[model samples]
Target: VRVLRPLIDEAGYIEAIEDPNAIVITDTLANVDRIVAIATTFDGEAEMDAEVIRFTYAEAGTVATAISEVLGAAGTGARLSVDASSNVLLVRGTQRDISQIRSLARAMDTSPRVAQSETVSTSIYRLQFGEASIVADLVRNTLTGSTDLTNPVAASVGEDPANPDTKIFAVGPEAAPISPVSVQASIETNSVIVRGTQRQLSEVSQLIKALDVRRPQVMIEAAIVEVSGDIAERLGVQLGIGENSQTGGIAATSFGNGGGALQNILVALGQSNAAALSTGLSVGLASDNFGALIQALNTSTSANLLSTPSVTTMDNQSATIVVGQNVPFRTGRVTTDGGNVTEVIKREDVGITMVVKPRITAGGVVQLEIEQEVSSLTNQAVTGAADLVTNRRVINTTVLAENGGTVVLGGLITDDRLQSNQKVPLLGDVPVVGHLFKSRSDSRNKRTLFVFLRPTIMLTRADLEKAAETRYRRAQSAETAVQPRSILKQEKVRKLPLEIDGLY
Candidate 1:
């Protein structure tokens, strides 16, 4: 009785009678029932049956607690416990109470089901920047939808025995269940028709807006420069030709006796001064000394600007430039039974080419994947071969650079030495005294090629306008440079008429 007092007190019941042999507890119907169940279990007088039921989907602990509360409210003396590891519920009570609990558990333990009466609506969303078919596919992948109705359903039909024309239909539980959401794309109209609930439509609208925004643009500027001997050394060491320089302009310099050749080439191309060369040189030069330094180098070494191409493309899109021709080469020859031979020729590109794909990242950094190649047809051919040989230099790599910054893509260097002697054939073979009869000359040629690339990201109209202005300025400078040459030619023509008249 004393031990039962503590249990009754904990159950919020007052024990009205406490004796050595009997104890009486009283409370609300639910609380009194719970206290009596506990005392009966302690006294070994309650008939209890234990059953373990495993749930397939519903959580065991949550279900057990819910069932326990319901049984307590109904004044049923049942004990429920959960085995979380096995996801099973343990029920301990009288046979009738356990039976009721099992029934309730079976009704509650099921996979979550969707509402069959949800209100569905259809909406047509027109895309501004993205293709309708593409956006539709993206939406389908993002949301769960029903299978196509065109697919066969799991059902069968049988003819009635009594009446041959009568038919009996047997449908499976899953037959012809329609989903609450559906999406279709109309390519001709450039819109998507979506049938779904309000929540689903809202989500689809947000996703389409995020994916259909305008794509940014990128301007890629490339420089291909070829230098030889002392010019290559000076460009590499002093000008930092292969380093990253954030400047975006062109500069020209010549070395030794190459000034005249450089000037002639520039004139022929109708360009002059800085506008005629590569922007890579402007990376390391100061404005105050730019002219003086170019003048000094103009008298020493020679360099050539092979090509300077500027291209603009959408971000993450590829741009290609080819500055050469396609030449045919023999691939194979087939002899026919009629005593005729046929040659299989394939055309291959021979010249300079560049392919670049730029991706703009956070903080205005540009990641570039570049493939550049310089190939040329060679005069050297195999003795019995039908195809001519070729020399190819290729660079394929990826690098990171800041927006409006320049980076060197790669370089190719080659060296060749030649020696020649002229004398009487027999005299050249004689030693010592034969030296006067023979003259020997030796020469070396070294050349280096550097490729520079710059990427400029344009996120707004102002950026694009700025880029266009820069290019316009360069064009104007080129036109100004060619003006003087044209004037000189005009003056020469004018004087020719005067000189001819005076001679007459």
Candidate 2:
């Protein structure tokens, strides 16, 4: 590394030292606002006039009055006052003669420990460290007995003056330099400063660096999870449901969890019940109730159990449900690995998983396969020993239906008439009149293994909400005579008039 020489060479040293109005701030200022005022005068023709300035110091009050009398004698129209509460010195003077006032202040500063004035007889050195006052005190004590240094003034820089961590000292030749190599410190930084012969500064530098060096501290910050600020307002439980006019259908799709995309899907299902639509069939009832139910299911009804705006159903006599399991298939292939011939066999699972993929057409037709799995338990007698047996049934079928329509998988299978007979214990045994005391009840049950499905296309959240609202209203209106149109119209105007629905 190359060492750079100071810009103040021997040739320029004399002129630099002779320049006036050169304010060198080495330690904390008794008055900090003066520097600010000086900088404020840079605009326009502004100059520091006989500006009234306030100063606070720990010395006797006479010092302030004395400064006032001196400024008055200098004919600068400067006035000094003492604030009673704070004991601060207030000085007012013409900006042009501010430097004169500073010089007078230096002379008036009677502290024997503080340096009174800058002179060619003295060289300034500043030492700075992080610890409060300790480093400056150490340096002062280290050279306290030496005759070369005088008026070691240590004070904290910046806003905190009482800290006394940083200091400046005037050290010069009480006689002459002991060595030829020159060394000087700078005023531009808050770090250590050393001024003397090169060898002296080098020694001082090593000591200062050693004192200032400290172990680096390591800090670890925990991770932060950022959530939307409006989450509570927009996704609160009240707005999550249909109660609020905004954020309808539980707002489940608005957020995500650690599980990724499908995390809130279950919540959406509970709120909207849109996962799988359900509809039932009644074979032979002497009433138009089934028709009304189906009609209600086809339209927007408050009772969602019947509503089927996107659904249609059909009855059938017989249907099939297919079951499939994937089986691994293997194939052997010859390949070259590192210039060596090798045969490798790869096995892949390739079988149907019983999932029916519907083929949708532009004409609003959906072709799909329906599968049903049924299991039954029965008791059997094998070689005079009773045993439990299990049987499984699988039915598969492919059918075509319009979009939003249902297809029954199986035709109606009617069971034989089942009879329940009751009679008096003894009277039923009388052969002749057993019929009089006995009562018989007969019931026949018919079942059509079917699937009622209506697959409607939902493009957006609003569409889904509309479908969910229709189902919700239908479910609520099951026992009432309210019209779906009224609900829709009122909901469009306001918040669905939940009071009128009477379903909070």
Candidate 3:
């Protein structure tokens, strides 16, 4: 609700019907009045400054109409989000109507979410990962273009980044006198002629291949709910949100694992509920106080991270809940060779750490320590990658742990709706590799080396490239937002239409 603070401060609210007997207590609520007065002054100053603003009014009639329009517009907007961090009140429209978005803020009696100099960074988790990228077209023309590369004899080759270029550089065959790449440098005059380097030729071939028509295509997608900067940054130093802005700045100074840590995140989480967008889902990690995105940006490997709920819903059905898996610490991975092949959902379970301090590696891997409520499902050795995390198909595995999940990665995949206190095995969905990890209710029970015993997640470059090549077959399932569209394979070439002298 937009309120002309000056008018609002002077007028207060005309309470249902104006009372003739009541003293003209127009200037009431001292704190509110001060805020309104300052804001009112700023509003007037803005008009003189000619700042473009949608017209608004604080009167009842105007308020009603404006709300109708805003809600109506929001109905058509791609996504609408409201975030409150510290003093910043962020209202996002969509790609369609940023310029013309009008909010009924002025008509609102409550404190306006937005104020002047409201410094709010986008909810790109700017601190977690520190780079940003946007696909830009060439200066005046599209960059993806045609290229002509020649092989020893005349060859009008089709564009292929892996093939050798004919015009600028000559590419020797895989089986040539250049077999031993280090020996032939003494042959050419004006230009240096070094041979036997298939690797070098291969790289050059790849660039020449990229030169032809295909800009980095961006895929638009729905934005996910993310934690705010203030919270993500805190997840770094303290466990369970040690020092944060829940109790304003005071809570942070008294940082510890007890109530202090949870207090920061819970408060910030309650207040934040942040939202933003990108062409494709991206992770922007910014250094402390980095103004905006800098270089050193690479595509973030998409993790199944979710935070907020979608707003599109009606009465009668159900409420939407959003949750994000947080990984405040560094991360490592151990994969079961999930090549392009889809891993079957053999079985499912949620591993709940019945105890606190379930021992997460410093590299951000959580091992839920659950009480031995039930014996092992299978007789496999309850250790190593061979072991499995027990799973029970349920939500919010509840075991009264210190903190269910991290603010950076996400909370435990536990359910709050579980019957309390009765012994519950850590829920495990997978038939294998569950259980053996149990912890106290609070996470501060024990401290393990943060970076120790981190496992590497391996996928051969060839395997990954092959996976990327075949992605188009199941394009619908690819995490295209973070991954690239190039993952979609190009049309297969049947034969190398090379005409003898000039390979076409």
TM-score of each candidate structure, all chains considered together: 0.54, 0.24, 0.16
Better of 1 and 3 by lDDT: 1
Mark the 10 consecutive residues where model 3 has the least summed lDDT.
288-297
Task: For candidate 1, write residues 118-168 as lDDT tens digits.
Answer: 346788999997889999887776653332211112221445699976534
Which whole-number lDDT from 0 to 100 does residue 58 have in model 1? 88
Error of 2 at 213 (Å): 60
Model 2: per-residue lDDT, tens digit, 332-435?
A: 44557667655454432221112244555557455655554433343333464323333333456766654333233323232335778999999997887988
The Cα local distance difference test for each model comes to 0.66, 0.38, 0.28
Which residue pairs collide in model 1, if any? 254-297, 254-298, 255-299, 255-300, 255-301, 256-299, 256-300, 256-301
Model 3 Cα lDDT, one tens digit per residue, 1-504: 134333455446533224542222245687556655565554442332111223222334444345556668436432223322222223343423333333334336354344222322211111111111111111001211232222232333333466555223323443222221211111222112222234533433343234332221111111122223334344334433333333433322222223344333333333231121111111111111011110001111211122111121111122233232221221244456654443333332222211112333334333332221111133234456433534232223212111112212222222222122322275432245333332224221111111001111112344334433332323332322354348677786344222322332
Off by over 4 Å in 1: 1-117, 144-180, 239-301, 380-386, 416-443, 483-504
Q: Report lDDT (Cα) of residue 37, candidate 1.
A: 75
Total clashing residue pairs per candidate?
A: 8, 32, 76
